[model samples]
Target chain A: MEKTVVIPTDFSIASLNIVKSYVSMQPANARLNIILLHGLHQSDSIRSLLFYSKHRMMEELCSKEFKEACYVLKNKFASQIKTMKSDLFSGFTQSAFNQYTEANNIAEVCLPVLYNPKFKNKNSFDLLPYIKASKLPVEMVGSEVDVPMPEKGKVAELFFNRVSVS
Target chain B: MKMRIQIKTTLILLTAFLSIILMFSGFVYLSVSNYSYEDFYKLLEIRAVTTAKVELDQEGGSQEMIALRNEFFEKLPQEKDRYYRISPGESFKNEAEELGVPISFFNEIVKEGKSEYTKNSMFYKGIRYKSKQGEYVVIASAQNYFELHHSAYLRRTLVFAIIAAFAFSALIALYFSRYVFRPLRKITDRVKEISSENLHLRLDNNSNNDEMSDLIGTFNNMLDRIETSFETQNNFVSNASHELRTPLTAIIGEADVTLSKIRTTDEYIETIKVILDEAETLDRKTKALLFLAQTGFNGKTQKFDKLRIDQLLWDVKETIEKINTNSRIHIDMSLLPENPVKLKIKGNEQLLHLALSNIISNACKYSNNNVVNVSIGASDQNVFIIVKDHGIGIPEKELKYIYDPFFRASNTLKYEGYGIGLPLTRNIIRIHNGEILVSSIVSQGTTVQINLPVGKFEE
Candidate 1:
């Protein structure tokens, strides 16, 4: 059995770095589908990149820059990527990513959202809808240094002057 | 030092005992003295009545009376216990020998009293008497009082006894205090000797399971944690060294391989280009690792100056854009505020620069030609900066371990690193007493949120 994963992104460097990390996490035999998404600011509400692409999204496919980016991704992930014209991004990136992330049997692994400050309006999470729709487990990872749990002997030092309530 | 309860109790007991002895001695001395005076007075009254009756009123003339009185007084020398004075017409004198019974008895019998009485004078205890029939006054003084001498000896002995008791109690106090505090003081000295270099050493345990034992127990638990922390730190250090060594070796080996060939300038420049890139990478990783470690050791060790965050963000973006690349990496910046979003923060500018650059570089390395978006501005209450990328998002589980030392996610090897960039960034932000947060998805992208303090506690 072959396992496939989906990567949803906002087309930013940080999000692309995440894609590289995803490439590293894949097993030797596992394959991946790089889904490049951008959410758009719909007139009334948030819409995914799928919606914006369907509506021709300010003529994104006609833009040479976008076309070139699509060509490069297609060339890089020729066997492992699926280029879609979908506005899964609510503003232009994250909302479309949220939709594909929820599609069942879509992938064995899926990336939820890669936020760019210019694209993301707020820091609060509204991903429960996506989580409920996507029946698969999501696992987040970081370098050991970014981990927040206090390691051995760290609790006392961190809370050296703390008076615990209980 | 605690007051030894036993010594205090003993002192109180000793003080009570001595007080009782002094009170009893005073009562006994007063009683004896009073009895001695009363007995002498009774004797004088009896002698005066008997002598006056026989000499003056028993059919005796004045000359015969005086001769008889003189004869009685002459016999007083044999008693060696009394002095008698017979003053005629208030002119009292000692008829036997010493005149007027020391003048003290004369004053008492004639000038101060009209009746027989006993009183104390300069050197003697005495009784005074007046005879109406002979118009004479007799004053008899005691040659020696025994109670005064006894009480004086007793007072001297008691003073010496009190001094001896105080000295003995002090010795007892010293011995008891040492006995009580020996274990505790020893443990204190032992605890002071423990340091970061040797956290494995423990407090020496005694057989006693007292309060100090509880403290030792807690300290032992702390030692367990320190051991684990040291192990983690060691792993981090080794992992960093290994990560750094790989690139360094690669850079040197690549340069060596290139130079070994006879090549033209263009070929040489091309080969050196790759080597230069590798060297740059090793340098970046090494620098990030050191910065992270330094922050870990002490946050306050670094001096902070005022920083303009808006300018810093713009500067980073400008520098990144200016770097020569194949247009593979790009940045799209936005400022929400109409103004330049001036924010004054207190922090080490160097650390801030390093942290921001590392994040931006990480974004560039993994984005596969995607754009890095950065936004910086200040809200009324806070200053915030966000760096986001459309690269791969982190796994939910691995995100928690990102800040731990030397730990990298399973997917993080694609871009070679010592895995300390984010940690370094975080530590620097924390030194400024600020916070950084993140949210990401597999392919959608990742966003890093940074909030720095503005000298909140200077007052």
Candidate 2:
């Protein structure tokens, strides 16, 4: 049976790198499914554009920096990816994520341990506390960089490791 | 050396302040240390959970886990003693020697789910983590280095703060005590300067209207009374000497005249009678002077007993009549109370008799065979004796001076008196805690009233 992993994303390059690094580190010939989820706090116009028409909204989503990130993921890991977006007001983010995992039969939840500039001293995943509290087995993947975000027009260092949780 | 009030007050205030500061510092130290330990324990729990996630994930090898541990967690010097163990059963092989943890301590952690303690200045926290693979116990310990260093810094800062606060408090107390007692010191200096020669001088009270001003005002009033008393005493001594010398001069002059020549039996007898009369006057004046001196010196030495004032008045009347058979003393007992206790007074009987006789005889002597009215009355709190005379009455201007020893009315030069009677009577009545009131009208009459407190006696 193919193993499925759930990943929450904010559509940023750093988030995309986290998913790519996690998938590439897996053993070769091991069939895996990756779900990229976006929990959105969208305005009425954006919500209507996405819900009312799919093709137009898809074109809009493919226009900006998000298009480059999605394009990179497709070229690298073709036919092994799925993407979904949800409005935050419809349900709690954690509950929605849990339901999505259950429906997809996800083997584990993979969370990106992104650095927050405000908390410069701590070097841990942003979602580490939530994943530890959750019932599901979750892995926090991140790199060790003193700075969280890359300089303008520069790429951040990418490394991946699974965090152990009790 | 005796401690000043300022120093005493400052020390007391500083002691109290230091006690409170010490207590507060202790409480803060205890609370901060406790919070630090609790926070450290929470960090250890997070470390253990993160370690389990990396080691048991099945996807990441030990090299990746080690790399992640190196990247995120800082290695402690005592890291060898910190470790986690997983077992399939309730018991596991002893790892105490390797982990430097007691076997019993591990058992306690497994049974209780969590355990925390401190030994040799190092804090240890252990937790049991249950998973599908097996139950695992994670025990972590390290020296409380950060907490101890922080606490030491805190202790030094608190010590300096307490010392500074006490020093400031002592200075403040000294200033406060001096400010508070400034008025008392001023009054003391002013009082020290006053003497009998300058009894008229008074303290300056033009400052704040507080208790200090009241004390100064009261002292000034006392000085006024003392000055008046001194003036009266000076007058009494001069007058008494003149009065005593008059009778002595007359007795000596008559004796010299009688001894200068011999005469017939009738002539000698007449000369002797004159000498006897002058001697009797001298003896009477001397006795009155003696009584006045004794009453002034030791009024308390006289024994006192309860005596009815009316009976005392009757005795005076009898004594006066014996002295002057032709003198009229009318006793008016109409106003006397039915209850004899109301007329009772506490006094030495001899002094009361002497005071009454002096007043009664003076009334008869001054009235010149006129009816000398003696009235006895009683009130709820006192017995009143009124002696009324209608002879040569005293001048109104001399009424206040009547109680002075040897004081005499200017119009009473022809009256036979040494002027010691009223003053002696006043002193006697005063020692018995009674009052003497005299009201007189020139050429009309004089009235003397004596009020004595009603005496209490057993049934």
Candidate 3:
């Protein structure tokens, strides 16, 4: 049986480091299916909700650099990784998360220990709280290799600078 | 034989509108039907639970409580109630048959709290009520008369509305199409009134920046081009005839004067020389005119071959040297591409030779035998040829008309030319898909730049 792993991502290149660390700990002969999940709020308009499409979301969400990075990772782990695909989790409720996990047959949730999810667009939100509250076993992978994260909004940067200087 | 655009547009609009109205009506009917079904089922379920509470919970089926329940709620059409006493582990197969429902309905009500079934506009709501007396299955069945009659009315109304909407939309579509296409019809009528005789007539271009105005602007631009080219053609014909007639008149006059009386051999020889010179000029003019006409067509009379542009330039230089020995022309090949394939282009060698030779010879003629520098260069997409002459350049005001056949600059009257060379060269270059740009300053020089697409190498 293939062990499918779900990793919540912000679509940055650094997010893949958690996936890399998780894969490194797995058995060499184990077959793996990697699902990179992103939290995207569905359109509130009835017309858009009626005609919702995930393929369109993927095109709008995935950047060129992010796709290239995923391609490189897939190739680098071709021996153990059977398939790699991205999916959107649009629900905000815990039951919805449970349904998503059940639908995808997710065995476990892997996340970075000290990671803050980045919203690529206005419709995106933090999915970590839902994942944390779910019944699935959550494994926290340490970002000990020090992946460079992009800076957030100016307010957070100002707060950080003041605190560090003081 | 063909339908008019206005009719087609109206039909298209009507079809789109009808489809939208039909879809909207269908959606409304489906939702209303769904709402009636759910509402009837909920009402039946409430009645079943209330009756179960009264009969099972009250001591011995109280008549007063039933009367009170009846007084508060309106009676549903053909309402009936059934209660079955439950025995542990006893299959309800017989009860299912008696109730005219599948056994799954009983099993669902037993497992889940309640279940509903529908058959022929009749709704059945079954509930499992556990009271102090015992566990009982109470099912309330009713005919949804309101739903049955209201749906029939709704269906009739929807069909009538759809038909009425179709007719109304068709009328609106016709009017809208007429309003939209009125200007187009006017433009068409105006266009029909214009002919080659009245090429200057243009449609009125209003100030609106809509599609109609764009079309009018485009049509007006087309008319401008037609009028300009027509004028050029007329000018070319008259100029060519005059240029041809001048030499013919000279030859005829000289011959007539010479033959008027007998004269000495030297005098006869002098007369023949003058006639020969005139005939030679006429021959040159006729040949140049013929070549100009031939090159005017786009690759009609010529066969294109992939030839190296540098080699073609060299051939043209050799031909020019042979024609005018005193004409000093230099070919600069310093900018040649390392890949020789970049230097290749698809062109007719003969026409190309004619074109390049014309430019060089003119340079020699106009510059009074000054050295002309011809350089060749290539980029990834195109090859460029630059020909420079340190000659008495064309006047600034006359540069635009230099390509007109038999149009010569004022200062070029001393130079022997019928003004056919530049126009012929331009035609040849155009047929080869090359651009020619001539920039000149009087008494200094003229530079002609020719840019042609580089030929791709096929496997």
In model 3, the Cα lDDT at residue B130 comes to 96
lDDT of 2 by residue, A9-108 (tens): 4434455566766666666555667665444333357666566654453454333434433443443444344442221212345775556557777687
What fraction of native interface contacts is shared by candidate 3? Answer: 0.00
Candidate 2 chain B weakest ten by summed lDDT: B79-88
- For model 3 chain B, the run of ten residues with the poorest summed lDDT: B291-300
TM-score of 1: 0.38
- RMSD in angstroms, all models? 21.3, 47.6, 24.0
Best by DockQ: 1
Candidate 1's DockQ? 0.01
RMSD of 2: 47.6
Q: What is the lDDT of residue B377 in candidate 1?
A: 42
| Model 2 lDDT on a 0 to 1 scale | 0.64
Kindly report which residue stretches of model 2 are placed more than 4 angstroms away from their true locations once superposed: A1-166, B4-17, B35-82, B86-113, B117-122, B140-299, B315-331, B353-374, B387-426, B437-449
Residue-level lDDT of model 2, residues B276-391, one tens digit each, is 76566556656655555544524476667888887877776875674577889888764455566666778877667777877888888888879987776655555667777777
For each candidate, the alpha-carbon lDDT, in order, equals: 0.54, 0.64, 0.77
Once model 2 is optimally superposed onto the true structure by TM-score, how far is the C-alpha of residue A156 displaced, in angstroms?
99
Q: Which ten residues in a row have the lowest lDDT in candidate 1 chain B?
A: B332-341
Better of 1 and 2 by TM-score: 2
